[model samples]
Target chain A: MNWMTTIFYFFGAITVLSALGILFTRNVLHATFLLMLSFFSVAGIYVLGNASFIGVTQLLIYVGGILILMVFGLMLTTKLNGKALVTENHNRLIGVLLGTVFFSILSYIIIFSANFEMLKSNKTLPENAVEFIGINLMSNYLIPFEIAAILLLVALIGAAVISEKRKEKQE
Target chain B: MSTIIFFLPFILIYTIFAVYGERKISAFIQDRYGPMEVGKYGWYQTVADLLKLIQKEDIVPKKASKKLFLIAPVIIFTSIFCGFVVLPITSSWEGTLTQNGVYFLLAIVSLDVVGILMAGWGANSKYSLLGALRSVAQIISYEIPVTLSVLCVIMISQSLNLQEISYQQGILINAFPDMENVKNYLFGISALNIDVTNWGGVFTWNIFRAPVLIPVFIIYFISTLAESNRAPFDLPEAESELVAGFHTEYSGFRWAIIMLSEYGMMLLVALLGVILFLGSWNTPLPNIGNIMLANWTTGEPETIAGNLWSVFWLLSKALMWIAVQMWVRWTYPRLRIDQLMSLSWKYLTPFAMFLIFVSGLWRLLMI
Candidate 1:
């Protein structure tokens, strides 16, 4: 159909396919890379939705920063032998049944929702959405921003303490 | 779109010359003649090397993952190519001036880490994996200071658009005294004060905007060195230890593509430095070649002449920075991995953060 619709579908397909690949891929490293692909495709979807700041932030923070750390942790902590690494999971039948039920419930709720029609509107964001975000973050969202900042600082100090304790134990 | 088409050849030819220039500079630093046999003053040395690389057989290691091995260079090259889309060659010249131009550029540039990781993992070698890990760590660590420094500039400009930032840098600080007496030169081609005199343009660049920004610019440049994996911070491909590092298993055309992407990245960093701090495409001289162009044109010669001058200045500035990178590479010894990490996280990051705070106050007070 239209260019926007086409782009939306393309990114949506990539996101879904890569997410599925992440679940199905036996190799842990491959799964991590697949997760990166999923994140990237979702970022592409965000770009298509005209929220470029959100899109780029997703790319910069998640794909670039967090994903690399995850990969490093996975590779260093786990050892891969000569044979292809395979992931083994138990309770497959119960897992599938639970997944199906959860999906159906979500779909049913989405279908019955009164505000579902809101998705049909192709309303665009303001051109200066970044500036708007900044203003909102400083004013209306100031409390949430401060909370997030404090939470992050606490996490940092917690990590430092844990590492220091571990070093002392090692010594 | 036309800019992409126009820039394609320019990027290729420029990469070739850059490689050649790097070789000659390195040789000069080492006090030896480089590539003397290939052509006069080694002009065709890179050309010959390119031909050799093209003719060489593509080799994929037996244990390597075929798909990832083949695709890694493509991903790296594509990421670098995408970054060029936002680079403003002149104030008036850019490919796509997206709303968040610099953010998008940085995002795409960071994607190269993914490609490097792919290359390292697909090769199925310990050395390759180690190199990739080091590179990813280096890039991520340096990115904090780099981004913080860029944020300082963004805070001052209050815009994410690269072209807007460039335009903001066009105002001459020295010309403040003459603002009342200076003639207005809007688009109407009226007599305007010579605010763009080379000396004034130098003073107007963001690096010179405030005393705090000078340190920020230095941090940014140091981070750029780390981000691009240049010498002193080039632990990723430390030849003395890892034997070509992440690209240990690559050969022939694929290796050439990786090299091309590396040079492309160097160019990207240089161009970004120009835009962020050096004032993209702004001529140093206030009234550049106005007298020379006046005799040939019936209409006002400002637009055409100005753009032409801007392009010349921008290219020269970017190229000069590239040479400086080469100089730094030859001058410094490589740092230890631990030292590299400390340089970024322990030093640059905190300094950059403090500078950002100071810059915010500076802007508030100045405004």
Candidate 2:
């Protein structure tokens, strides 16, 4: 159809393909990279859907932060004995059953409950989504926002304390 | 898309001259001549090196993972190149119309860490793996301070769009009538009785607009230095220790691509620093009484002359900073890993957090 639709389909295809690739790839490192690709494609879809702040944040947190940490952890843990790091799947029957159930539920929601007509109509989103989000967070969602901040602060302190205890034990 | 096309050639040419410039600067610092055999004043030395690298054998290590090894440089170059897409080069010529331009630039740039890791692990070398791990740790740790410092600018400017931030620092405020409140104050002081909306210069820049930002700018510069893996923060690629760090196994054209992206990262951070603190593309000349210097310097945004002036100012300022990066690189010895971590976490991060609070107070009380 339109260029935007074409681009959306392109990103969606990558997301799906990369997800499948991650599942099938034997090399653990390759799977991790494929996961990064899938996350990136999903971020692309978010940007295409006019949620750029969410898209960039997804990139910042997932691709940049978490994925780098994952790669770091993988490298540090994997013994480099002149061999590729490989993974083998376990509980295949249960995995397939769970995956099928989740897929069917998602498909059912899309097919039976979704309003395709409303999606087809050109409903304009906010011009400045960041400003809109910021306003809502400060005004309407202030209590929840502050609570989340406190929760994160607590988690941060907990991490520091845990690490400090380990250091003390080693001492 | 057009900006990408324009920037590809600009980056190539920039890398050429920057490589030569870095050599010459280092040579000057060491009291020795650098690259004397190429073109006039050794201007074509990097060009010759480029030619040589292009013809060299492209090498992939024997035991390396072929796929990731081959793709790592591409990922590294692409992620850094993508950062340029959101950067506003002139008042009228931003690459993309992203509302969250600053945030997008930062997020995309951080993706390079993934590529560096890929390069490191894919290389299958002890040196490469160690280098990549060190790089990832340093970059991840330093990002906190850099983001926090940038948050200070975002708080003061009240916008994340790079172009809007640029416009706020110039005589161009007349174009946005809604920003009258911001324009009325000179250096965030209404009592000055001097409207700096027409005055575009150092006085109107972010460092002066909120003087608390001076220390914030210093923190930003230092953190960015670490982010780009330049010295004295270049422990990731410490030549004495790691023999090129994460890119140790790369060779020929792939190595050239990594080098190009490394220089590109430097330019990108320098340009961002200019935009966030120095003044973006706005002229440094201010309008003194009866002088109209700023008016004479900056042209109308729609005009070709204006675009040229904007490009000239922005590039000159950014290039000056890049030179400073090189100067600092050669001046200071590479920092040890523990010192680097402590400098970032203990010093820069706390200072930046304090400045963010000061910025909040400044925004609340001053403007």
Candidate 3:
């Protein structure tokens, strides 16, 4: 009905399309690329929701940081001479059954969930909302913020330990 | 104006100028005549190059993945356009939705790495894969420092929203020197020496305020160079080993998108430098430009001159930073991968943590 809804639909379409691409693609790398598309579209959805900071962080950290790491790990460990890059499940019936079950559950919740209407409020423009997020992160979430620092340090050390292959003493 | 959109050729023409500028700049720096042959000052060289890329039969290698192979370029081009949304272009030169702008802008940006990774993997070549992997490692490692450094700014300014961050920085005057006098000026009270230069953050654009931030800035800028895939950190496509890096199999508009995304990324990193390191849209002096123009509730200055001036301020700052990046890129030789890792993990990582600690202290003591 409004501009925001229009944007939501557009991004939502892209998200679904990319998700479909992820499901249909055979190549692992191709699937990853589709996942990138899905991630970006979801970030767009975040922008639409007015949580611009979180959306950008999601992109920078997830697509840029984590996914890249996943792809790189795949590259490093992959035996390229192998026949097919894409891997799929042999049993489609069980897979489809599980997929349908999950899909049905989600749909049932969406359709049957009562007492709430999808009435949208023009809560914020994108830029203003981001500013508020910044404020809240500093003033309110300071503890979590400090904790995030410690977590990053732990991650850094953990990654170092895992990746650092101790050289065996040559006989 | 929509009329300007019709002149897409104008953008094309601007490409020629961009090429000439690049040539002329590199030439000047190297003390050579760069491009004098093609249409004087080699202005036509980029057009010539464009024509060449256009004429070259677009090739997709036989072994390459088809779907992702084609889509890679499209994603790059689309992603590059996203940065413009949040960036405040001159004083009054507001571009698009400034709200939720950081996410809209940065999300599209980080996606470029995905494109690079895809370009590498889709090529189905050893060189492509190697380059892609290196790019992945390099981007991820450097990203931590870059994010941490940016966090310092976010913490100091207390905003994740880019536009508001820009607004919050605004030129603050040091009233502490004359606090006794200033207080007098404010509350009709008499002069007290007060013993401070507005000691907290009223002065020094973060740099002057926290001189200790210099190391963090250095670490950040260095890692950011890697994050933007600049030289020294550009090990993924190191020319001697991998030909053209991950883009080896790419051709046609796809290659164009790749290059465009790259330059666009270069521009983004530089602009972010302007925001974080430089005073952003704020002038060095207090109360010189109209801060009110930044607040969107009041429409941007209606006059063309006013809007143009603000746009001037924003662009000038961004360009100055780009120049700095170029200077650094040309001046430094590429770092080896091991060296690069050591710099991030061993040096920058620890150094950034220390900077954060120091920043906290500076805030406690000064604020």
List the candidate 3 regions with Cα displacement exceeding 4 Å.
A1-3, A13-26, A75-79, A113-159, A166-171, B1-18, B31-39, B95-107, B169-206, B209-213, B251-253, B284-304, B364-367
Candidate 2 wrong stretches, greater than 4 Å: A80-83, A116-121, A165-171, B36-39
C-alpha local distance difference test of each model: 0.78, 0.87, 0.63
lDDT of 3 by residue, B1-367 (tens): 1212322343344344545565666666665453656676666767777777776777888887766677767766566656655676544444455544444554566666666666776678888877877886787678778767876765554454455555434422221122233211111111323322222122334554445656767877788788877776778878888887888777766677676666666667766766665655555443213543323221244456545654555557666666676666666788898999999999888888877776766554443
**Which 10-residue window in model 3 chain B sums to the lowest lDDT?**
B181-190
The pairs that clash in candidate 3 are A126-B99, A126-B100, A127-B99, A127-B100, B90-B310, B90-B311, B91-B310, B91-B311, B180-B192
Chain A accuracy as TM-score for every candidate:
0.86, 0.87, 0.75
Model 1 DockQ, alpha carbons vs. true complex: 0.57
Cα RMSD (Å) per model?
A: 5.1, 2.1, 6.5
- The numbered model that scores best in TM-score is 2
lDDT of 2 by residue, A76-99 (tens): 877556566888889999999999
- What candidate 1 gets wrong by more than 4 Å, as runs, is A78-83, A114-123, A165-171, B1-3, B171-200, B287-303
| Residue-level lDDT for B63 in candidate 3 | 80
**Residue B111 in candidate 3 has what lDDT?**
60
Q: Model 1 over residues B239-263: C-alpha lDDT tens digits?
A: 9899988999998999998998888
